[model samples]
Target chain A: MKPLDKIQSIAAYLDEDAVDTDIIFPARFLLLMDKKGLGGHAFHERRRVKKGETPFILDRPPFDTAEILVAGKDFGTGSSREQAVWALADLGLRCIIAETFGEIFYANCFKNGVLPIRLDADTLARVRQAAGREEEIVVDLPSQTIVLTGDETISYDVDAYRKEALLLGLDEIAVILRDSGKDIKAFEEGQSRRAPWLRLGPDKWKVFDDLEKEQFIE
Target chain B: MHAHDRPRTLYQKVWDDHVVSTYQDGTQLIYVDRHLVQEVSSPQAFVGLDAAGRDLHRPEAHMAVADHAVPTTERTATLREGLAASQVARLSTNAARHHIPYVPMTDRRHGIVHVIGPELGFTLPGAVLVCGDSHTCTHGAFGAVAFGIGASECECVFATQVLRQSRQKSMRIRLEGVCPEGVQVKDVILAVIARIGVGGGVGHAMEFAGSAVRAMTMEQRMTLCNMAVEAGSRIGLVAPDETTFAYLKGRPLAPTDTEWDAAVANWRELASDSDAVFDQEFEIDVSSLSPFITWGTTPEESAPISGRVPDPAAIDDPRVRRRVERSLRYMALEPNTPLSGIAIDRVFIGSCTNGRIEDLRSAAAVVAGRKVHPRVQAMVVPGSASVRLQAEAEGLDRIFSEAGFDWRHSGCSMCVGMNDDRLLEGERCASTSNRNFEGRQGRGGRTHLMSPAMAAAAAVSGHLADVRDLWPEGTK
Candidate 1:
């Protein structure tokens, strides 16, 4: 993942609320485990209602190259599929401005170097208007602001940790393993002594008995 | 300071117990007690781990199963090569390489990740459980601090056995009063989602309490907590009690003998302090909630069976009205039409939400002397093979098949629409699955979410009929 500092592009507008993960990236494509090439499947329903036709707003002229999306409240509201972000990022979207986002999706956006910004209703209305006109918008991560048409700027809030992670393109797993290894080892050692039953070893598992086995096994 | 000195909600207690490290930004690296993996969401996580040259930190603490990708039909000697097969194969290889406990498709214990976790006693009180699927909240029924994680987080768990998480505000929803007759546990959860709109529980850890929740069986409690994600809350918890202990007693992975006593003693303390404060609180009288069902797209876009399709014109909020109008259009429903009179093309009675033995028995009881309507193609897919066997032992499968319904093998089935069991385009279905989103069952497929018994009733009547009106005589 590359560090995301700023993006300047037209914002594609999705006017619907509760634009859930399923709608963004349908559940059917979940079997496609490879994260790449999902841009073709994002919003699979809306992008092409028929073969050889692209009717969705994102597929249209000026918005086709959009790196920013302005959507209604509760965007990415269903499922914890990270593929939703993968698909959007694959679709060339770098930032999403919404009234609110599903908490898991919001967290995932930062992990994938996609910024999810929750703006106030009034500011969101202005952003929506700018998106409707296909006006160019600039999202600057360092400044934590979205610049709309006519130089009108709106500030947004993101977790300090997530913003830093996104800007630096830090691999969170590597960072944790490097910084917190000792603490993690200590916690586990202490927990095992206090609650041995909680940390069962492989040999301790007792899932089946020979007699009742007939009931569970084929 | 002693842990007991500070008043804490069940969530706070569990969160405090799992904190391995805290960062300056207020996020904590919380140790995960149990990790459940399924085929669809896990393959990429394994790839990422391998790409990072990381080894699984605790393979013994994780379990993997191929549920969503497996067909709910009789298994062939081997799966034909394809996307589904490749995904399942990848998971199997990953499990073997990582030494994680893998339940193959042929294993009787193989079932929906959430269902098998509790069934095999892998889920326990006070454990911090996670899976890539959002329905992992089902484990919270046992007082576990369980929630869903993305595949990236799954890799983190594999690499470090901990996840970085910020604290969530606590919300307690009290289901007061005795549940009225004809109300299923599914109805209780659906009613709760309806009360708190899909986004109502966002950013909060929901604790289901009050008398009605206490009266529920472990299976019933699982049903209630399974759809917590549908309400936009990542976690839904019920404090462990005698019911929870009884359910865990002698299960395959559960503690036994002296260890059992010790585990139970610890679990007894996994409850909210009497005077603990919640960030937000809501109380719903279960006595007042009737059999709930989704009439439109979203889970919250539902009303009681006695109600009619809402007229979008009557809605005051333009955004909500537009959404409703679009939902009604896709559902092919008209305003003011009685919910019961809406005809269906199919009936599907299963999912993590309502696919347990109890759910099967309830549906079977309704179809005991009846037959599926000639126009309806109904099926019952158990949550797991264990659940299927248990249902068969009780002869529920016979009742379902005798009623002209398909009694199929266990998997996610039509609930996810990734397998062979799917609704054809524009097909209207009365299903027990959680989500009713467009294309959820299949592209252009319409779904009306209901309880298993209600789904069975729809199979018999070929419409969204009330289970109460069709209950077999002499049965409650």
Candidate 2:
């Protein structure tokens, strides 16, 4: 995973709210979760340049090199396929500036070192307009602001932990292990004290292990 | 909590209970209760784990199963080759190496991950559950705060058994009015999504309540919660009640004797308080609600079974109108044509959403003495192996097979176009599974999302027909 910080890129627009994982990266190519060779497959059907077919937005002017995808509300809405984020990242998209995002997709973005920045509705409108005018957009993680051309800046919100994780090139588990071992131990103790039944059933293996002592089941 | 401060909704309660600590950046370290994993989304997670030299924090908490990647044709069929086979094989090896228990493809316990988890009683109330599949939200029917997580997050949970989280606003969808016979819970959920638009529940926890919802069976509740993600809500919850306890009472993973009583007592407190205020509220009167069917590519583009395809001219919004027009083009339908009279090429009655034994029984009753149309190729794949066995013991499988529906093994068949089952180019289907995205069934395949009974009726009639119209005697 590449570390993201200050990035400047032309923006492409996908204005449909509830832009789903299937539309971003269809299920047909979701065989193995690889991060490379997926950018071309992004919007696979829509990107095909068949005769009599109109070119996809990305194939159109300005958007040809656009590296920031400005999607609509509820962007990345359906399915938990992380390959959607991988496709965008593979396309060299460093950030997705959207009004809102599906909770799972938003979480996955940070896990894969891609930033899903949520902006207010009015700010998104300006960003979309910026995309039309071919304005270069800037997303600075340390500064926590999205700067459009001409000095106009829209401050965005990133989870405090996530911002630090991005800055430090840390994934959630790495962060938790490095900084939150006490919390994990506390959670385990609490679970044992309060929610013992939550432990998996009397080990199916344990009951069978006794017989396994006599013979391996397989 | 002050008077102005509303009682915490069920979502807030569970979320707050799980947070180990909150960071300045607004991410909280939240403990995970159940992490259900499947083959399609987990192979890479295991790879990531191996690369990181990390092991599952609590392998017991992670329920590994092979669902989406295995064939539904025969349990004995070996997956020795291809992408699906390798993925399934990797899950077994990963589970074995990690000391996690897996309900293997040939095991009687093998079923759709979502179906088997609850059947095993692993999805407890007041817990936060997650899986790599979107239908993992089905577990929220037990009053657990369940949602889907992506593959990378699956790796995160696999390592720490926790997640970095932000809070979601809460929405309470109260299904008021009488639910007449034949209007299944599937109809109620689809109608709710249609009324609330696909994006209406975005960034919120959807907690279903009111008369019609309370009246539904556990299977029906699962059906409702299953598609809540389609509405863009991560969490879909129905407060735990006696019905929930009854279903959990004697299941394999559930407590026994004295512990059972104590556990039920604790779960009884999982409901939202009377004064709990939701950020959004919606009410749907089920008295006159018809069984719903999606006519467009999105689940929200739905109408009553008896209605016509939405006319683009009637839509004032140009963007929406164009989308509807495009959807119609893909679906191979004209604007004013009745949705019912559309011909069907295939019918599928399985998936985590509607592949339970009850779902099988309902579809079977519709096709009991009738044969599937010659033009339609239909199939009934159970959600789990146990569900298949139960349906068989009840002769439901025989009924479906006699009706010309191919009864197959357990897995998510004909849902997301995986496995060996897929629709041909331009073929139309009536599907009980959630999702009607373009080519969700197969490349260039059209889909009409409906209930299991409706799918069965479409199988028998060779077109999208109303189940109520075909079975006038009412649901058995």
Candidate 3:
């Protein structure tokens, strides 16, 4: 994970609302565990004609070097596929500005060290317009502003806790375990005392594990 | 808070009970009741665990099943080629090493992670169920607060048998009437999605209530909760009742009669207190509902079977008009076209939503005395091996086969399209699964979400037609 303070780069564009993960990475490639290099297959149906071909958006000049992505409303609205976020990250996209995002997908961006910033329609349109003109676009997450060239800055919003987590390069697990070790221990101790049957030791666990593989016979 | 102010929703009680600790910043660590794992998501989490040099915290907390990677074809036993095979292999290796309970394909209960949770009696009321898959909300039918997590959260849950989440706002959708003749729970959910847009229920846990939902069977209840995710809600629930207890009794994982009575006594208190206050409420007159089929990419883009495709000109919002235009282009459909007469390329009658025996019975009734149209390709996949066996025992397989439907094994066959089964380019399909999103079934495949009976009717007619007109006499 990496802290995302500020990003200044050419921005790519995708203007379709509800741009689902199915199109972002497609289910065909979902079986691949490694998230690196998935950017090449991002938008497989929309951007590619055949193998070794860069089709519509990615084939453009400045977008090829984009570090920020500007998309329409409800971006990443389908399956909880983190591969889409990984694809953008692998392609060096640190910031994605959209009108709205799918709930799970929005949460995923924070976990993976990517920023999903919700911009109003007017702001989204202005950003996309700026990208079309090849103007330098800067997103300062810590500052909570989208900085364009010529001193124009637009305020942005993020979950307060999430913003702090991103600024500190912290994962949710790290944050939870840091302060809750005592609480969890107490809870576990109480649970064991109350429900002794649930405290399955390794010896007792094997009895249940074997039952999991019980086969069907005709 | 005063005594009069203490009627908490089920969401509140379950959420409060599960919280291990809360921080000053409103970040809470909640204990996970069940962690359902599949091949597609678990492999990445396993890779993360190895990279971090961390072992699984609690093997007993996890349930691993190779579902998404396996195909539903007659030829089972081995996985198909490509990442599907390798991913399943990774899951097996990881599960074996961690000593977690792995549901093998040979196991009769091996099925979609959501289906198997209840079938095996692992999903209980007043618990929290988490999975990497979005449809994990399906498990909420048993009164659990279930929701999907990303691969990163999966890894977190793998390393620690708990998850960190803020509480979601609570909502209730009350349906007050018996379903009209020929209407199924699938139709009810589709109509509900149509009324409330895809984002209507966002950031809320919707509780389905009223007399209609109370009358539903356990399987039908699962069907309704399954699509709550598609409506932009992570969790949907029905209060635990006698039906729930009866369905869960005598299962391999369920407790004995004495233990069950005690558990039920606690679960009885998990329901929303009378006069409970919800953040939002929506009521539906279920008797007025009709069979619905999605006409476009979004689940909200739907109309009843007798209705017509919506015209962009009729839309008031410009952004909505733009989305509908793009959807129409991808679907190759024209505005104002009668939904009933549109021809379909295929029919898929299975998935976590509509793959239970009740769904099979409904589809079987439609195909019993009719032959599938020669031009249409129809497939019937059970949700689990046990479901398949039950279908076979009741002769549903023969009816499907005789009517030109390909009867197949269970495992998320054509719904999300990860494995061998998928639709070709420019194909139009009537699917009994959730999500009508573009390329959901395959590349360039158009899906029309419908009920099992509607899909069966489409297969027999070679087009989208009203099931009421095609309903055979004496059918349930």
**Candidate 3 chain A lowest-lDDT run of ten:** A209-218
Query: What tier of docking accuracy does candidate 2 attain?
Result: acceptable
Fnat, model by model in order, equals 0.65, 0.54, 0.50
Please report, as a value between 0 and 1, the fraction of native contacts recovered by candidate 2: 0.54
lDDT (tens digit, per residue) of candidate 2 on B1-476:
22335588888888877888877766688899789888888888888999999988888787788888678887775676787777777788788889777777877778888899899887889888889988888998999989888888888889998887788899999988876666777888899898887778878999999987787789989999999988888889999897898899878777778777777887877788898878999888888788899999889999988999989999998768878888888888888889888999999999999999889988888898999999999999899988988998999988988889899999998898778799998999999999998878888889899988889889999998988887747574
lDDT by residue for model 2 (A1-218), tens: 66778888889897666677888888878876566778888888778688887688887877878878898777887888988888888877778988888778888888777899888878899999999888888888898998888999888888777777777777567768898889888878887768666656446334323211111122
Worst 10 residues of 3 chain B by lDDT: B74-83
lDDT of 1 by residue, B329-361 (tens): 999999999998788999999889998988998
Q: Show model 2 residue runs off by greater than 4 Å.
A: A15-17, A59-62, A119-126, A201-218, B1-6, B472-476
Q: Which predicted model would earn the best lDDT?
A: 1
Candidate 1: where is the Cα deviation over 4 Å?
A50-54, A206-218, B1-4, B473-476
Model 1: lDDT of residue B425: 95
Most accurate candidate by TM-score: 1
Error of 2 at B26 (Å): 4.5
In Å, residue B458's CA in model 1 sits off its true spot by 0.7
Error of 2 at B282 (Å): 1.5
Q: How far is B383's C-alpha from truth in model 2 (Å)?
A: 0.6
lDDT of 3 by residue, B387-451 (tens): 99999999999999999999998899789898888999999999999988888898889999999
List per-prediction Cα lDDT, in the order shown. Answer: 0.89, 0.84, 0.85
lDDT of 3 by residue, A22-62 (tens): 87888888878887788887887787577677757766787
